[model samples]
Target chain A: MAVSRGFVGRRPTDSARVPPGQYVTRDFPVLSAGPTPYTPLDTWDFTVRGLVNRPVSWSWQAFRALPHENITVDIHCVTKWTKLDTTWSGVSLDTLLDAAPTQASHALAFCDGGYTTNVPLADLRGGKAWVVDEYDGQPLDPEHGGPARLLVPHLYFWKSAKWIRGLELRQADQPGFWEMFGYHNYGDPWKEQRYQGD
Target chain B: MVSKTVETPRVTTIAVAIQDWPGHRAGQHVDVRLTAPDGYQTERSYSIGSAPEDAYVSLTVERLDDGEVSPYLVDELRPGDEIELRGPVGGYFAWDNELGGPLFLVAGGSGLVPFRSMLRHHRASGSRVPVRLLCSARSLELLIYREELIKLAADDLVDVSVTLTREAPDDWRGYRGRIDPALLAGCRHGCFGA
Candidate 1:
């Protein structure tokens, strides 16, 4: 590693809290691969399918009627920004998976804008992930993934697919959109897995 | 490092020569990693501003006031300074002449970096693709690649429109205010589906 001649970083106080090669950012930067998609609430729905005992889906009204939890978690983007204690309200993936009854060990989250991210089913179970709609007690904005988005805080933010439409459980692992391009199939920010072969 | 040019007060373009660099497509980015004297390292991704046809890879960076990396990249780096970076990363957002289109490119602030690469590629490859670039900047003075973009707009197949969101010269004519649905709808005619 070539040391930059006169470079000095912020030297974040809680170094232990941050993953390797990451810095804390109070401002949530908006990064996208395409134009922001606005899905009308009247037609919005979430589904769980593929290799499940039976497919299950919830309309916007039915989804809101289900139990909700207010969670505060630290989110780390693969781009190297970490936001701490971001509060969100949503239904847990466990809640959804419980209904679907899947024996699959992998999942592919598909979104409205054709964005997809794969995660192991093991990482998403036992109250580990959610389908969040409210951020900081306010309706999530379109630019920040409104309507509903997958909230898998443990993995890189990209794995938390925005404008999330459904989770398709798979019998075997498969690469998602970014994974197929260059990103790591299982992006673990703590491992500094930003690209393929991190 | 090859050369540096001041694009705007807050933006600077750095050109670097990479060894055995596989040529990159337009709209690709590179991950720049900087290590301090103490081994405290940070990395950031920057969109390539130079076309694959260009002799050197170029990255135009905008200095964010509170940004840790941008300030160093824009203000401190110099020619001959060794910097560590990787790739030609990203494929989803890349554009090439083969992807023929009446392309509609929209950008605000430094977001125009990748489109610069695309535009340059279009010119270098002699692509006849109809291109429309809608760019927004706080002011004319703050627009990156101001002169180059104007010269590129001279092409019959390319149309460039600028919207000054903050300030404009008294006699300036182009566009003013933010890019909203109305402005997009006006630009979308005959270009999107046709």
Candidate 2:
């Protein structure tokens, strides 16, 4: 390893909480591949389709009527910023997936801006993920995927597709926007898997 | 590192020579990793500043008051120091001359870094894409590539408009305040066919 001269990292007191090559950040950094889409709540809806016994869809009003949970979780961005204890409220993927039974093992999360990210159905089940519309007691801003966004806290934040629309269950796994590029298919920060070959 | 240039008060551009670097496209980024003497390592992604035609990879870093890596990159590391970096990664945002245009690019602060690569690629490739750029910075003094942007604007095919959000010089003659829909509409009108 090439040691940088006179460079000492933040050296977080709780080092174990931070993944390797990552640092803690209090401020939320907004990163987007394109302009933020402003989808009116009335037209916004969430769906679960493809490889399911029966497709399911929920309009904004109906989705909000579903049981919601307040969650505080650590979000790790592949950019190396880890914001811990971020609070959010949303309907769990299990609640939505339970409504539509599927034996498929993977899903391609499609968003409003033509952006997509793939996640294992297993990761989306068991309350591991949610389609969040609220962050920190306020309606999520359009820039932060207001209306709704998929929240998969375990993987890199990019996998948490903003402006999330629906999940298309797939029999085989495939690459999404960043994954088609150089980013790793499964971005696990703990393993330092950032690039395709990493 | 081959050379370093101070772009602004808080920004510095560092060019490094890479061995067998597989040249990158415009708007690509690289992951820069730095290790401490105690074996502690940290990494951050930075947009590539140099055009693909350039001989070396250049990265423009903006110093953040509390940033773990930016401060060290902007203020400390010197030429000839070895730093580990990966890629020219992220193709989702990359641009190439083949894409063709009426291209419209908008950037604020350090966000202009990648567009600089695109604009350079635009010029170097001799692409006659009618390009319009609307850049925003806190002030003229804080603007990166101020001189180069002026030179690029001289091209009949390229139009560069800057907006100073916070402060502007007494003689400044450009847009002011944050980018609003009206400004965007005007910019869009200039590039895209009405």
Candidate 3:
């Protein structure tokens, strides 16, 4: 998306990198549909279930015990802000999937307050996604999906649910809250899929 | 586009009745794009000010001296004008009465637009959800939707508090400073826990 409005001044070089309709911003705008949720760490848990013969669950300690990775990537929010070269440390979705193998082709990430977003299983595997708990060497702030959030840097940020608690594999794709409300089911920033049928 | 002055000269309410509104939850916003005759277009997003149940979608815009869109939107646009728009966008910051119970709203300047939608929805739906709104403005004159908010607060279901940062009336009885821990704590007891 190439935004050339006066507010989003454009240069030739910018079009080569930033996705269509997205402007690069040094500031990370805090955009939430509702109030920030505060879930105590002691009560937090991560689970992998649905369509799997044997489901897996992890307490906060158990999840932290898994192998972790430090990653640096750029993230784009569907609301049109892009933060580049962000660093995060967490357990990769690949590692989580390997723990409890499944044959399902789609996944529904379940978060606190019943928020869920569906993604193709392929987009999640191969080092593309992670359950991130730390940002820039600090515990992720609750404002930014604190305890842990699904990090799918390749897609629009809404697919990366905050306060995420689990991933439920499924045989069929089920659109999440935003998806059901006209947001693109598969939000690819490069395509500028901000809404359904975009 | 239909425009009305909501607060001061810089603040104006723009309403449009489109066939595809589909209705939106309170606190949702729409992205608007304005195009010049030569097709040079600029887009900015604004919070929708009308309740979801209203017949038309509306946005309250605050004109900035240097802003490209707001200047034209606030000063040049007239009734029956056309502009491009998309949205009712974002899921992270939306609320409806269905979320149930106590709602605490905090506003700074034009930030009151989305919360206005929430309040309207609450009143229109006859919801009994306890709502407390803490609004911070430069002064009473700049407060948007003042009359409606006052009317809403007349009901036991709603509570309204205002803090004047720049200028306060001589007889002001409300908060006289900016939002701080003390004021936020007051908002917490009877409203949303956080």
Candidate 4:
């Protein structure tokens, strides 16, 4: 299938949209997030392709059927909030790739809404990442990447692709959303990997 | 910067209706957190886009394609929902009058959010520190803080220079490109707040 347009380099523009001090929430969400998701499982479709000798596509059911496992861990974002004691369930990318047999050295992930992040297959294997399908025993909610999402616990939260579509196995790696916009491509919370220059 | 973690709100953005907002300096940000359905929680640090005088915090977020926690904060979030956040994170990035100089703010996309507070502080206290901003976006329509930025420019409170990457056929007459030094140099220094 045709891929959506990737983040293209564009000249920058500026706006003083809202007045300063006006948005100061007496209280703020503990997280930096996009609009809450409205993902519906019936509406979800996950695909994995690229550089692999054979690309694989899995429907939600087909995806869940592949394998199921649960793990509890802490995740940190470069933005600096660390959430601990989180339980997530899903199929491991390594386990899945074990069957698919990826010949590609590099990997780029794409999501349902067409966002992409470049990563290394080595990072995936080394990080003990997975394509998580469930959270806290119940099937994951759509807003939380219901059907499935990529969970890279070691890297910053941005590495966790929401509404994940598939993996594009490439010979080389590429940066994802925040990376293209100047966030550090390899986000390590321990090192405070927030900005590109950082 | 002092911070205390709170609970995630039902909505993403809110009026920050809590009484007695903790005092914070301009150009500071509060760290926010939220709990996912499965008890998995996520956190992100955002610039306190509002000035200390303002009643609430406002964050302008562009949905990241795979932002595990961000999408909920940006898209599904609304005002009046409960959420968790810690006050006024980051010290150096925060604006301090003591730093003492005309301020030139350059922001890329949502990066401009924190600078908003700086402008407001300057405006309220009459800092007169010569503030200028170079905001870069793909198009004029996509410009955030469009109305406010223009008003500030018009009022001579701040010197605003804008560059558009993708111009509409009808809107290509002015500043048709990236922010070059020329744009920065041309901006008349406007300063009311330090």
Candidate 5:
């Protein structure tokens, strides 16, 4: 069981690109709390509700009709894996928010299998977040939050909820599935906010 | 670090005693760092197999021929050795007493470590959570904690079943093939029906 490789320890080369306590990974690892959900696009829908004056809903056809931005960004997960130069195309949160104006300060992205992750309204707006359905110029894989998932590259990948179905606007911050357990309320990878009270 | 062979020639359970170790939840993992004498360092995350109720924090490592860290952990590491480690990391992939009942666990090969912690915790806490574990391993010899799992299952605290991917001993009563829908359904029926 002896492996002989002239091994050199990993050290952060570019601090600005890779966050502290994080390592760059070329392959996209599949990390999920549970099993992947496969919901047919024919019945898929997206909704923006909660603190909005009037909630708006979009069927699969209608959601795809919205203007989309082609983005290539770096994503960091709390598990210490960072995928760089990833590309995606989806409707920006600003566009979805514009359609249903809200006075809320917080947004919780709710998805299939009762998964939810909270993010500030400011984080979602101003081209910071997107409800993405396309990855690498192809339809999103269900295993990777296909049909659509929230893409907030600024925060930990868990904040970008997979299989996203709706956005629940809130006046107060609320913890989601992982957050309620022990994950940091705001998973800022740069700060290495992995566990609670970090 | 105190090392003991668990699944035999390849898998070893390393127990490291840390002072003032902040207790961990069942099914959590830790990041272990190994520093070469020349100061070259490598770290990898491993699931905790010792229950939170246990006195020492332990990790079970299976030597992967291509792994940079595991080979040293399984073959070279010995008792009274010192290594740099951090954690009780990853709060998301964990379970506890408060989150109770009808626990369903499925493990593929060495993936059984975390679930072992959960099962041990369930037994230690005296929680009556109905647990069913389906361990898919190459064979009985390759399965870690085989004896312990059998004892636990015999005690009726947990229902354990195995699916062998490679080869099973002739007259193997469990399963002889890869996990399919039928195997899963049979496990469910066996557990719930009884």
Candidate 6:
């Protein structure tokens, strides 16, 4: 490490933004929501709390066997690059909302790492979101928040929390980690909501 | 100072000429992107700290630990290295005399990048609005642009406030604490803009 700082060795290039391509399951896996993988299915439970008529709690297998599928899309990170054409599998937020029977005006998804993000119920049911379990064709990778990460395509990537264990539907809108520290709240790419002022 | 595009790791500063190759605004940030050996892409947005009047653009790149971007920049980039970047990417934070007042610049870590642009642009434009730049760093060694900033503060072109969070030398006489409101008041109010 040179005592002097502030020089980048390489030129900035879109050369690094890999094009959309095929993916498979091994490339992805559910990771790090809770402490372990084989969480005793019978003993395992997740709750859907936060602003709803009836909070639903269910076992792991019960949620798994309900219904599942996958989708492919592009992800734009706040760090400033757009990754195109990736695949994922998981339950749709619509399905979860339907089963959970929530009339809450708003919902905040909660997961491990004390992570939470707010999304309106309309956004979940309107085809803009999902509870993605698979990525790049594999079961989700833990680092990418596998097993299940919220897939909110319309908002910035962080809004889609990874390694999610539960949902806490809130009636109000609250900011998340980066938001509390000055990063944008909604984080809409088209709107360029990357930082505070905007 | 060079006009040609160079492939550099991280651009500490860039001076753009011609105002062409897709012109730029002072407060906007460009994406200085690169690819790691493992194929994971590392990209970061650096504010265009250079004054638009200047023939070129400049950005200050402060390295971060495991910083996929900055380390390569400060250590690997050399003169005439090719740089891939796209510019002028922010709006809400930019300076607009259309919405003018005394400016209070507060930066923690790398957050100061934008303010540097705003202040430099102010100087380049020859504006008289007083500006106070408060920079916080872990210690003296980590202070970016230390000599240049001190000169700027001493010149009184800008009122600078440096808060050292840890390991101050015995000779240290400036503020040696965090960014509390009280400490902030200790600075020149006329320059800090309240």
lDDT of 6 by residue, B101-159 (tens): 67778776666666766776677677677777888877776666566566566545567
Candidate 5 chain A, poorest ten consecutive residues by summed lDDT: A1-10
DockQ of each: 0.79, 0.79, 0.18, 0.05, 0.24, 0.06
Which prediction has more favorable DockQ, 3 or 4? Answer: 3
| Tens digit of per-residue lDDT, candidate 3, span A1-198 | 323233333332366567766667778788766668899989999999998889998999999899999999989887667788899999999999988789999999999877889999999999999999999999999999989999999999999999999999999999988898779999998888888889
What does candidate 2's lDDT look like per residue over B1-194, in tens digits? 88899999999999999998999999999989889999988888999988999888999999999888999999889998889998878877888999999888888999999999999999999999898899889999999999998888888888888888999988777878888888877664222111
Error of 2 at A33 (Å): 2.0
Q: Point out the higher-scoring one by TM-score: 4 or 5.
A: 5
lDDT of 1 by residue, B1-194 (tens): 87889999889999999999999999999999889999998889999999999999999999989888899998889899989988989998989999999789999999999999999999999999899999899999999999898788888788888888999999766778899988877764222112
DockQ of 6: 0.06
Model 4 chain B lowest lDDT segment of ten:
B1-10
lDDT of 1: 0.90
Q: Which lDDT tens digits does candidate 2 get at residues A32-133?
A: 888799888889889899999888999999999999999999999988889999999999999999998888999999999899999999999888999999
Docking class of 3: incorrect
Task: Report iRMS values in order.
Answer: 0.9, 1.1, 6.5, 14.9, 7.2, 10.5
| TM-score (C-alpha) between model 3 and the true structure | 0.79
Q: Which should have the higher TM-score, number 1 or number 6?
A: 1
First chain of candidate 2, TM-score: 0.97
Residue ranges of candidate 2 with Cα displaced over 4 Å: B188-194
Candidate 1: TM-score of chain A is 0.96
